[model samples]
Target: MLSQPPVWFILIAFIAALGPLVFFHELGHYVVARVFGVGAESFSIGFGREVAGWTDKRGTRWKVGWLPLGGYVKFVGDLNPVSMPGEEKEDLSVEQRRRAFHCRPVWQRFLIVLAGPAANFLLAILIFATFYVAYGRPETPAVIGPVIANSAADHAGLKAGDRIISINGSATRYFQDIQAVTSLRPNYSVDLVYERGSQLRRVPVRLGSEQRLDEFGQKYVVGLLGVRPPQLVYKRLSVFEAVPAACGATANVTKMMVEIIGQIVTGERSPKELGGPLRMAQVAGQRASLGWSDFVYLIALFSINLGFINLLPVPMLDGGHLALYTVEAVQRRPVSLRAQEWAFRSGLAFLLALLIFTTLNDLGSFGLWESVGRLIG
Candidate 1:
């Protein structure tokens, strides 16, 4: 048997990551629809068979589903999970038709459609803000802890304990900021502002190309400056301090995601970096073993990711609906139903293929596929 992580960790992480995240995502649609007087028939977490359920005062069925990967909300007069289903046009009671989604004003409908992704983003900000407010901010010292021998810093005479204050004349408040700048390119030169003894000094470092293996065992060449940041120390924050701190965290995460995506698009990063359910299960198992704090952090990060992914402008996603709404606002007409149908079908197929590919990657990364191959061999 492979050395797999515990089952309980896997279960908890999966539930925490997908359960509330998906629920809130769908709930965004539900709440906004209700606000616009659209009657939501059901707000469900997951797919397939229904498990536990309750009826709300508004007569909405809130239920848990068997499949735990995602969820959806069904609204009155909506033919599909999304609001774009094509059904036979039927005459409705005035009361019933009045509460239908299509009867709302364009702006109102747009807001309802936009709310799902907005909720996800809001959740991420809130989680990050809460963490920052509760524990203040944990940061590594800007002083260099170690310099790799023969690395870029070594050649530039950069030594351990040197405190970095800026890069290329730009002030850096965090060690991560320095590391990000260093990863630009091979043979690139960056001016470092640092404190040596009692004197502030500036030095130029030429980054060198080095091959590094990621967690997936895929090797890629990246520029390295070879200075390490010291361990994190918790800093206290005042009531006024938490908001900006949280905003900073959100901005940092957004920047990192943008960089990673840019690297991927430019072929500087590998496609194998994409992961799916298996990767999540593996991470959950590992984080669970670390402790509750680590697990919670992982959950928060994944929740942010969940929010980000839904905002991509793909048909069948919340962003796609927003895009359509924006176009409608500009042109003063809805897009053709035929166009939407084809687009949604294409998007669904693409997403399914992506899921399959990511699942395979995850299994390979976890050594599950390798072990199976060995057994067959």
Candidate 2:
């Protein structure tokens, strides 16, 4: 039986994983702010009241807060939590006004805002590359492990121990390739070429349906072929092969992210798929139990997600700041305060609603709702 993780362990793992990511993200903004000659008042890792802190030679107060959810960098002459507020122009004294974020040139502001997301992407790439080199590449030969009786693959005459050669005449080197192709283009009959007893044979299989959970409480049906592919094993590679392997891993992860986004857009995935700190902790704990390398991979993936999210053009995010800067560059003036306020308000509301939905989703995922239903039933 698989061992279940303790809640405390999950919480600890969440903090450990999120802390450095948050720090690096905020530090990216701070570094670019300094480069742009923007005076930063304080840099905080986490939110709410400060716990432990120290002042740097640059007069930036670096502090850790009680809440480990997220962090921020406070630039001089910023009125609101977001340094991009409209009244930041009028809120400070003449001397302080000179140090205001809005006072900076548009290009400088753009770079400052762009740095955070850029840093996250860079971190993800580095972490992924490092892990790849350290653990060797994982590879799965295109071999069949199992075929469920009377299922698609079995009906198509696919047998255990058969080596898959191609799908629709396209050569497949790895089992993952076949799985990927099947996952994306489900419900269609696939022409599979396989090797059995030294003979190559072609088989046509119709994908069958399986129940899957999405963002809404509704269960959806997905097509499955009832074929289990061989597992990926760690295969040590030469230095040259390691580099390509790392690049391939990164590319694969990027493709997965794009697919996930597309699925959400198509309503094939739920908006409630979004997760907060609670979900992060659960995943972190599960990965931690898997082993150090698995945990590191999870961190790299999460870091990439952080990078991708920060680049979204939503108000109060790094990308949102960049969007505003782009408009100011073109218009030669900032958007009016009323417009900024309304945008921020709407963004905040949207974020809150998303948070509530995701939190509910997380609870449901943990079987909380199901357990409650069982008790009542």
Candidate 3:
């Protein structure tokens, strides 16, 4: 049985994790718009009716909303909070026209839209760099340790002290890289290149897998090669050196996310693994209990996820807006209002369905259905 955190703790942790990310994301757009001389009417931390607000010196209303899951910026000359151009914009005075988002150059509008996701990626890099500078990098060689009897690694003629040089032609710099590559493709065959002394060999290995239960009673099926990594050696890096390493780490994470999404789309992985607010809250609380460093890492991870999600070319999202801008740039005209409306409607429907499904997954992960069944019996 898994011990669950108190509901209050989950709520607090979730808020602490999400609030800053949301603020920074929206702030990115707001700042860039200001740079282009576009005025914002309102800047909100969350959606829905405002809970509390005050007008800034620049006349933008800054507010906290009832819903904390997401946020937005309402630019001047926008019909509503979605940043759709107002029909009345054409009738605006010269000063109002100058400050209207839609009236800005297409390049400026594109940059403003792009800034939000860019900020999120930047945030993750900063967090990772800070951690690397503080604790030094864990350098673990990709050498095979003791092999489990009858395991895939043992049957494949892998020996102790053999160094994994690459997987399917991609170089493996660390033991972690080997684990990452193998863990995603259970029951699949991969070409493994390893070095024994001065001799290099390539062998095809069918990965093995085992079902494991976590503390929350959720099951995961991960590929197993039955080889362990040697003890980690810490290498301290200068701040300058850590910056590029941090950027590489962030890029790798983004790449892995793209690959996982592709797998899910192609039916190679289960969509049920998708999580929603409940799972996030649970994980946030658990990480917070571990330590501040753990919690900070969680925040960075979520920030990346949020940024990537927004970059999907779906209407009503930043990517969708970018798509529209691209079309506008090519055609030298904005997309028709009717087309924009339909696209936004479709996007809204898709997002809503995704939210509902992921929420259900969260409930299933928490064993809520099982608990209900037991009570009924």
Candidate 4:
């Protein structure tokens, strides 16, 4: 059984994990805006009161905030750090208007907003590629060691020593490929091709699933094939090979995220599986405790997740700004201030509600909610 992590350890790990990622993400925005000659009023990591800060020669106030939950780049001509538009030419001199983010062309603004998420994706690729160069990519042949009795593989006539070649038409060159295809697809039927005794055979099987709790008691479902793996293998790749492979790995992670989110939105998966800061802290601590390598890998994974989430078409996000810019591009006019305000309010409220729900879920994972209720009674 996994034991609960210490609170202080979790807190430290969470901060260590989030701080750099946040900096890199916001740095993306700041750099792109600078390239387009748009000035930033403030660049901040975290929220609320300033812990430490300084002003740069360019007149940008850089700071670390107290909350440490999220960060933002407040551009000139923005109402607040969220980047809503401020007063136009009437209140500003010619130079100020030129450097104002709102005064920039729609196309430039779109790319500037997009750069944040783009940086995240690029960071993930670089990290993965670095690992591939430093350490050989680990993989093993798709050969089954032992089939679980009365399990999906067993029911489908799969046995030990069988080599999987493909699943539903996609080649499975390695054991990792097999895992990538099946792990997110709980209870799904697929055509699996494997070589057995010099003969190729196909079998159809519905995957099995089980609910398990992590070290911190966060629950999740994962599809199972019920087959033991063979001996490990690691293949060193050249720089050229590593970069493309890294791209493929990033794409695979993004695809899995999309599929899982689709299931959750469609009610196929429990919303309770959704997690917020506390769940993140637990996982971060687990990774930190394991080793620096594992913790760094977690940072890469979370970077991709952060990129994907910010790209969602919700109001008050980078994607939301992009969406509005898209509309402005097509319609040749910006959205009305009243409409934008209404949308922002709705988005803010929805995000707050989600935060509350996920926090409650986190507390329940630790049995804190029940304990509080019992105490109240």
Candidate 5:
């Protein structure tokens, strides 16, 4: 059985893991904004009160905050870090107008908002590519070893030695590919292509699912296909091969994020499985204790997730900004400030509710609620 790491280890691991990810995410926005000649008023590494800071020659106040949870970059003439509008259009001098974020063309604004998530995806890709180039991808043939009776595969009329060629029209080149699709789609029916003795077959199978924990105790609600793999093999890639492989890996993780979030929202998965900082800390510590490689891999995984989450179309997210910019692009006019404000308010409320719910989940994960209940009884 895997045991939890020490509290101190978890705290250190969490901070170390989150800090750089936050910096890179903000840096994406900062660099792109700078490229467009938009001046940043402040580049903050953490939220809340400033712990320490310095001004650059460009006059951007670079600061660290007491709260190490997350960070933001405040652009000139922007109301807040979320890039809400603040200053009136008429109040700005020509110079301020030149530096203001809103003054930029809609396409530019869209790219600027998008750069944050893009940076995260880039980080994950680089990391994965490096690993692939050095070590290689773990591969197993997409041939099934056994099909448990009465399971999804059995229901689909699959048997041992059947080679899965594709699922839902996507190529399943390896056993992991089969898993990547199936794991995220519990209770969901999928169209699968498999080959047996030179004959191809198509089947629609409704997956059964089970709750499982990884080595680090990360819980997952994964689809069960009732098919087992044969063994493990590592296929090293050239630099050219690694790059595309890494891109595919990044795309796969993002797809997983979208599917899992959709499942949660639709009640196919319980919201209680949602986690917050504490959950992250525990997992980080476990990975850290294992070694630097594991820790770095966690960083890559979390970075991709950070990027995908920001790209969600909810208000107050990068995706939300992109959504408005998209509206502006199509209409040839900006969304009204009043409408933007309402969206922002709604987004803020939604995010707060999410936070509260996730915190409760985290507490329950730690058995805090159970402990309190015991005391009450």
Candidate 6:
């Protein structure tokens, strides 16, 4: 088992990993707004009081804020960094109106808001592609190395050296595919086909259910086949080949994330398993200790996650901005300012509640509450 790092290491790793992501995400919004002729008032790398800043030729203040957790861009004529439209937009001169985000066409505003998440996704793809081109891809064939005793695989007569061909009629090209298929079907019997020394065999295996707990003590019921794979094989690809492969990998991650979210929504999974910054910090620290490659991989995963999260249609997110633009397009008018204010307030509340819940989950994982209980006792 990997040993946990000290608190300082975790904090440093978390900030190092997250800071670049926040910068690029906000950069996307800033660039697009600039392209659309909208002037930005400020480009901040973090929140709270500004620590250092410089004004650009365009009069945009580029600043680093005290808080390094998140960042934002404030466009000209916006009331705040969240891009709430200013009431003074109507009274601005022609030149000022041209530079104002709210005064821009709905489509342009939509694109500007959409750019932030889009940038994060693009960044993930680029990073994955670069890694693939440099290091080649790991191809783990669906060949069984060993079958655990008393496992579903053992009960179903699966043997060492068997190569899995398909699960539940879906052809599996890699060992991960088998995991992907079985994980979603806990306690269900599935038809598994494999090849053993030129002979093909089909077996009905009832996947065993295992209750696993995370570092946070959150429980999960996952299907287990109890088989291990042989050593991984690396396949070198040309730069051109790696791009599409990287895109496919990103898409697969996105699909899996969506499925997990859906499972949580349907009560198939518990929301207690949700993690916050502290959990991320722990994972980041562990990956950093492993090596640079592992750390970069973690960054890529988090980047994709950040993009997907921002695309959710909850108000105050990038997706919510796009959603409002869609409504404006359909209704041939912008949503009322009062309605927008209420919606934003509600979104902020929802986000705060979620943050608090996840933070508590993190603290519990660190045994903070247990320590407190011991002290009280």
Count of residue pairs whose backbone atoms collide, per candidate: 0, 0, 0, 0, 0, 0
What lDDT tens digits, residue by residue, belong to model 6 across residues 215-257?
5344567888989887777787888998898898898789879
| Alpha carbon deviation, residue 10, candidate 3 (Å) | 0.2
Lowest summed lDDT window (length 10), candidate 2: 213-222
After aligning candidate 3 to the native by TM-score, how far in Å is the CA of 144 from where it should be? 1.9
Model 6 bad stretches (over 4 Å)? 156-171, 181-205, 209-222
Q: Per-residue lDDT for 155 in model 1? A: 90
For candidate 1, write residues 114-216 as lDDT tens digits.
7887777667777766776777676766788889899988998988889889877656677766766666555668787889899899888788888776443
Give per-residue CA lDDT, model 5, range 280-352, as digits (tens). 8888899999999999999999999899989989999899999999999999999999999999999999999
Off by over 4 Å in 4: 168-171, 195-201, 211-220, 372-377
lDDT comparison, 1 vs 6, better candidate: 6
Per-model TM values vs. the true structure:
0.84, 0.79, 0.95, 0.92, 0.92, 0.89
Tens digits of per-residue lDDT for model 4 on 94-154?
9889899988899999999999998999889888888988897877889998789987899
Q: Indicate the worst ten consecutive residues by lDDT in candidate 6.
A: 213-222
Give stretches of model 5 more than 4 Å off.
146-157, 185-189, 204-213, 216-221
Clash pairs of candidate 2?
A: none
lDDT of each: 0.77, 0.77, 0.90, 0.88, 0.91, 0.88
Q: List RMSD in Å for every model shown.
A: 3.9, 5.1, 1.7, 2.3, 2.2, 3.1
Checking candidate 5 for backbone clashes, the offending pairs are none
The model with the greatest lDDT is 5
Error of 6 at 321 (Å): 0.9
Predicted candidate 4, C-alpha RMSD: 2.3
lDDT by residue for model 2 over 220-289, one digit each (tens)? 5556767786666667666677666666666666666887788788887677666766787888887887
